[model samples]
Target: MSELLQLIKQAAMEQVESSKPVAVMIGKVVSAAPLEIQLDQKLRLTEEFLVLTKAVVDYSINMTVDHTTESHTHSHSYQDDSTSRTTQPHTHNHAYVGTKSFTIHNKLKVDDHVILLRVQGGQEYIVLDVVGGGIL
Candidate 1:
């Protein structure tokens, strides 16, 4: 019985050693090349790909101020335009300053900026980390 157990353990160890080593791919993830190129196939960029970029955007808010009143002639009420005060209803544009980062769901180029991936098996790879490509 002890010998059989030992044999089983050895077989398990040999199976583990025979398997392919897990590959660690650290670089940009580009799509599979064409037949002419004959490069490894990878994840391709699409029209709805996510990317980061820096941009300056301005925000404005519209506000309404009510400044209308109806005046009626009354003996008790004061009758003078100077005594009554009202503010003009107007809107002023406000400008926002500073640069901000925006997430864009657009197409990406062939080359990648930076990425970390793990090859599960064959041509399959899982993206671990990625950074935006282009000017920041």
Candidate 2:
């Protein structure tokens, strides 16, 4: 009975270890107007990173049968900038070390959302995404 219990515990431990999510770092906000962010280390996204910029709101609005009141709403659109570059696949080595820059051509305001993903390699990290955010 003790041996059987030990086997079960080992299996459970293995399952939990395999289900852990990878570590992700929130990069710094670079060029708020252009919406650029610098990561502390390079990031390799499986797919193209999706960034959404939104405006910050203070309150909201509500209407009643007797009277109406105004509030605040937070919302923004994804604007395309002429300088925006499409997602590309590339590899780099230690030689490419240094602060790398990625520009979000679209005009970004405060409180915008930036989503990044690894669209290509299964578990391998891409060279471009593996840079330090401070370098930018």
Candidate number with greatest TM-score? 1
User: Where does candidate 1 stray beyond 4 Å?
Assistant: 1-18, 29-89, 92-107, 132-136
Determine the backbone clash count of candidate 1.
0
lDDT of 2 by residue, 1-136 (tens): 9999999999998777566654344444444544455444564222234323222212333333332334434444443674544444434333333344443334333333333332232242222232232232
Query: What TM-score do all the candidates reach, one by one?
Result: 0.27, 0.23
Misplaced by over 4 Å in model 2 are: 1-22, 41-48, 53-136
Question: Worst 10-residue stretch by lDDT in candidate 1?
Answer: 31-40
Query: Whole-model lDDT, candidate 1?
Result: 0.40
Error of 1 at 33 (Å): 11
Q: To one decimal, what is the Cα RMSD in angstroms of model 2 from the true structure?
A: 23.3
Q: What is the lDDT of residue 34 in candidate 2?
A: 46
